[model samples]
Target chain A: MTTTASAPGRPAPVKPGRPLRIRRRMTPRRAGSIALKTLVIGFLLAITVLPLIWLLLGSLKTQTEWLNSPSWALPENFLNFENYQVAWVDGDIGRYILNSALATFPSLALIVVLGVAAGFALEVLVWKGRGGVLLLFLAGIMVPGQMILLPLFSAYFQTHLTGTIWPLILTYTATGLPLTVFMMATYFRAVPREIFEAAAIDGASIYRSFLSIAFPMVRNAVFTVALVQFFFIWNDLLIALTFTSVGDFQTIQVGLLNFTGQFGQVQYGPTFAAICINVVGILVLYLFLNQRVMRGLTAGSVKG
Target chain B: MNNVFGNKRAVLVFVGPALLIYTVIMLVPVLWSLGYTLFTGSVITGFEFSGFDNFAKLFSDPKVGEALLFTLKYAVILTVGQVLVGYALSLLYVFWLRKASSLVRTLVFFPIVLPTVAVSLLFQKMFEVAPQNGIVNEFINFFGLPSVDWFGSPDTAFLVLVIMDIWRSMGFYAVLLYAGLLDIPEEVMESARLDGAGGWTLIRRIVIPMSLPVLLSSIIFSINGTLKVFDSVLALTNGGPGSSTTPLTLLMFRTAFSYGDYGYGSTIALLLTVICLLVTVFIFRSSRRDLTKG
Candidate 1:
């Protein structure tokens, strides 16, 4: 964008200008620097990914091979994928994944819907208590999640939401509400109210205007919120542990945690295979939606 | 002009559902938890008025004090570690790797989405030294060094906890700080370079001062998050090595569930809540001053 500052007449044609001079002077030193940088980056990438790769490879190896050999040892049976089967059947990660999906998807949808509406209300519509309501949510964003656990547990049992996905869903949505509202509100505020006003003058109701104008304007934010909330719910362990305690009802996290205790000592292959089962979904989502995930994760910091 | 947008009912219509759910699930629970601090028993054991009894216990209990001390230590160490590693990674991103680091950044951030339980289990297996050969031990053996019991003692276990945490979330802070670094306009950087500010000096005098707000925010975020940490530690060591790794949250959780002492558990939770709130406010206030100065 700023290349316009150094246009054709500025300095390019005279005495091989500053940029060209720097390039000419940079061959040897730049090569060394580039090599150094690549090394550092490679080291970092290894730290980030080598353990995960080892986890995958280790899972493919049998328990005896995994323990007897060093961590870096390659699996003897690349064709044998029995560990995943064991993790799914014996560890019951399949059930847990199903339970987690049941908990995450519906709540994520509800949060998006509720959050978008609240954002429109506070950020677009002229309401008397907008600041008060916004303040409520801003405060909600800061509320330490664990602090609400005991009372939520109390309510969970009373309402019969415990031992099922309902309590986890409710907890996720509530905990996710503040950020959802805040992010969506920021998106809504950026939207031009004049469009909504024009729609109102055209005999369209405010609800209709929102559906037609403001909602479309804030679709990116809605998607961002959905992705972020899904990540939170799926990654959550505290609420899942407290609320979904039944063996059949546990989410992937709780299931994986319990399964670890049972198998971590001796059954390294299946244990890690179960861990991979849980992570693969998130990893795949991350690969496909890396940019959106980056933007959504960083969005919180910007708004805050 | 009589318009549908002019009505207050629209406000309620838009905001009501979210507020209702948030209030029922979050607001009410917070208040209920506060009230629970004054009671002395559980659902089955019945309740009794225990005025200041839980608070009194919180102070006298040596375990509570020990847990508090550990929580503070953990918060300070982990927060600092995260900030340093993140800052370095951000510098690497902007100054060196540029677009080449995109794949690396994605890989780094991948762990942030993995369940804490899974990562902790991974680390637990990796660091295991006794009874069987885990990865870390395997690595040490490959180098001709004797195996060290990583989690057999309090100090090593706590160190592993700290290292695992930094490994898991360092990417988040790095990416966050990198975004902040990118926000420094290219023009300012070029001018700084032109003015003979090179490398560390430029970063020290220019970037640090410029990105103070984001830096402070990241610090506060890490501190508050670490202060209330439960699941990661629970999954990692379950506050093991003879309660050496036990944080305040774990202590509170066990008190409520394992011991069925709801009142005392709630009291510990309230302490954690107050600490987190105080950190948030303090850092927020401090950042406001710094931000306004810019």
Candidate 2:
């Protein structure tokens, strides 16, 4: 692990003294590195975390206080659960949460099932002219999802799928399958081809090779692809807003926005509180699943 | 076509359901929407075949023109800012702040999972007027300057929307670039340094050139994402202050769903799809040049 200690235009390496590469230069380059690092990291932190912090602080403040105070400053009070209570019962996020779960969980489940089955078949199943099918799969990636909005809406209208969660789930599964299949197919392709050959020579059926051998080898990719698609379907708002306008089927994105106006008041505090909960919940889940998802993303990129 | 030889039958079997569903749900609508370019129609009443009237009408329509211009403006701002900022941040994480990279990466990518509507709502409240305390306005007032209407005005509305988008996507691009940076073999950087190539020379001459594939892909992703920009615009301004923030998707939605001008709306959708596909192909081709050079 060779490290670049210095670049051009900078010289006079300092005596190694204070421990841990602390021997430093006070030149503009050193200062710029420190300043640049500080500014970039601070800007990212402020942009990413501050909104949630502001949301939390706003949740604790009264409507008057929140509206009147500067956004970044904290509320004067502490641990006020009143906003949470109002947000849960009054704003109807309780029901919205259920709606979101209903829409997201099924889509996620379907995406995993379809993605894995397709990935396995593409990888392990012996087939001539599978290249064309793979090209069709890649074409899905090239298509921008919004292009389908009109026809999807029209399709739903004719199929009686409108105003129900089914349409959103179905659209989500379709849109999600492309990238999932793309990522997982390449991933499964990376599994040693000889292993599948050996399994076949042992009189193992194609289904058995996929079920008993290839599946376990690529389980990490499968899990990561599933979780990433889960987040995609979960964070979606356009499809939800477009396909289902019945309000009960609104996912959290549409749900949270509509809640701001629901109870005959602005209710900024509770909306902020609910947002705080949503932020923390998703962050925690992503953190737990981050490693697997990131590996899948990088794996896909390298293959590309 | 013996069963054993053509057992690719099962391959089709496995991939068929997903491809069929995706084609029906996602691809078919795009094709259907493209058909709208040939007709003048309402959503409820069937459309008559007018053949290119919708496209011609699109040129004459001021709102569609404005929305297209705005979408381009937004894409330019977002791609430039996100790429530059993301590259800088990736440099910081890779070369400067390796120890904090994991925590920073997780925190930054956290926003990628956030619902756009929620982000828009956060910004909306933060920029709301009449309170004198909207963070942006407050900052303006604290500087002893008159507070400008941020989203309430056309120029500022587009600017703020662009900023929100940059904030959302910069981290994403940064993480991707960082991964590319990691893929750069350590010996190359050391050798570059041994040759006294540092700072701008090292980055411009080496690091960036090496990461061109990732960079181009990020650019393509940003362009596609910006061209389809909707949820935040919908949640933030709803193309308000007189359609200043309206992008293609919003315009398409309005035409198709809001105004019941299905023909015109589908024309816009087809136009956007073609534009996006062209851009994607262009980026992919350019990146191929970079990859071969590698």
Candidate 3:
């Protein structure tokens, strides 16, 4: 809601024609500031956009053309979809994408469900050893992911869960819990205590209050945490690679690695194509969940 | 009708599933890793419990020693660089460059959202040696500097990994810091200026102290992330050039997957966990007000 107001107190309606008058009376200092801003903005745009252009260009050109063509220039053709087809088929990125979705989706759902409960427990529910419980969750966040890899591998080995996505799915869910709980708890804390108190007076139990009142109020935050967890799980490569065999349950990131073998011959064209696909998928997801994450972060931090 | 259940039990019921899964998968694994540090190799070989033998071996292993040292060096450098560079970029975005922050945020955060494997591939092409059409080497040759054997030489490869990682992550830290900066009231800055505080004085005293929590959190984040680095290293160097840039995680990976020494790998992993715990405890102790008390 602070989006509209630059300052607190009286909200002034924007004066019509003021910007035009301001520009008409602009001093040299203002013009110089504007010019410098434009230059910097352009520089940032190039840095962001150029690599993508290079990736697209490389994807379009054949190996010979890619080596010979100037890196700055675009490819000659726009209709080239050969690389996409090749990446889809030869790279088998299509299957990997499916596997990634299957793994990430369940993990995302579990994070939201469990995270909401955890957030509720810490912030609202009265329990013995509350600080100890919260500390246990925080400890999960502090543990370096590397330290768990071997132990997880050994544990999974004993359980005969090797070469399966279940271990990865479970790990992602657990690893994601601390962050999701943090964000959700921060959000739920901001809801007026009176709302919960009123519900309690009405004989609504804590679970009832949470389910009927708190959860609905923080839907925006839940969406944000879900998006963040989705992105993390989707982009995760380490646990995916470590837990699964090369071809059995490979995700997109691990599948992408198969393009560059030990012989140093790289399938740059399809590899770039696969990267583009994955990036586009992420970008689309982000765009879809844009407002939730951005606003969620702001709300959570400002309160703290 | 609902009086049959109390609040405490309801809370436990609601929280139980998540706590169960997390403890079983995450907490148990940690304890199991710690346990692995005790047994000598495996049970199949009629293993005997050798108390702290693994921990002793860990201290004595030169490779482990080297990896830990290199990881510490890189983590220190990366944390400092990330905070400084990311803070500067955030300041630039918030104050000097408003419109560009919008554009640059997207650009910088773009890499962070991408899979790490793809980032490694992109960097590999950029850092490919000179006279071979790599982007970075092409620029080096253009400047008439001798092309660095990045990714080829032990001396320079670690630097390449560091640079690429920074490029990929600078935006994430920048975004976090930018958000922190944006939270400060403009009136505070104006008042500081009116009070005749110099630019550095205003930033160092007011802006920085206000954002200390975010800054500290960013440092902790960068340290943790750098310590567990695997995907980028695996894809880029695979701990090559005689293990010059092999971090602790990469070393642990080689121990388990490459060598099938699960017991030893778990030992390395446990030691790393202990180090991380110590560092995290230290950070928490120093910044408890910001992280926990707040």
Q: Write one digit per residue (lDDT tens) for candidate 2, span B214-245.
A: 77777877777777888889988889888888
Ranking by DockQ: 1, 2, 3
Tens-place lDDT per residue, model 3, A1-304, is 7778666777566786342233366789889988988887787667666666777677776666666765444666777878899889877889989988888999999999998988887777666776687778877876767667767776777787877888888999999887777777777779987888888888886777888998999987788778777777888887888887633788888888776662257666677788778777767765665545455443333322
Off by over 4 Å in 3: A1-33, A70-73, A200-207, A262-264, A294-304, B1-6, B42-48, B130-132, B144-146, B284-294
User: lDDT tens digits, residues A115-203, model 1?
Assistant: 99998888877767789999999888777776788888877777776676688878889889899999888887777777877887788
DockQ of every model listed? 0.69, 0.54, 0.47
Candidate 1 wrong stretches, greater than 4 Å: A1-21, A25-29, A263-265, A302-304, B287-294
lDDT, candidates in the order shown? 0.85, 0.78, 0.76
The TM-score obtained by model 3 is: 0.88
Clashing residue pairs for model 1: none
TM-score of chain A of each: 0.90, 0.83, 0.85
Query: Interface RMSD for each candidate model?
Result: 1.7, 2.9, 3.4
Clashing pairs in 3: none
Top candidate by lDDT:
1
Better of 1 and 2 by TM-score: 1
- How many residue pairs of model 3 clash at the backbone? 0
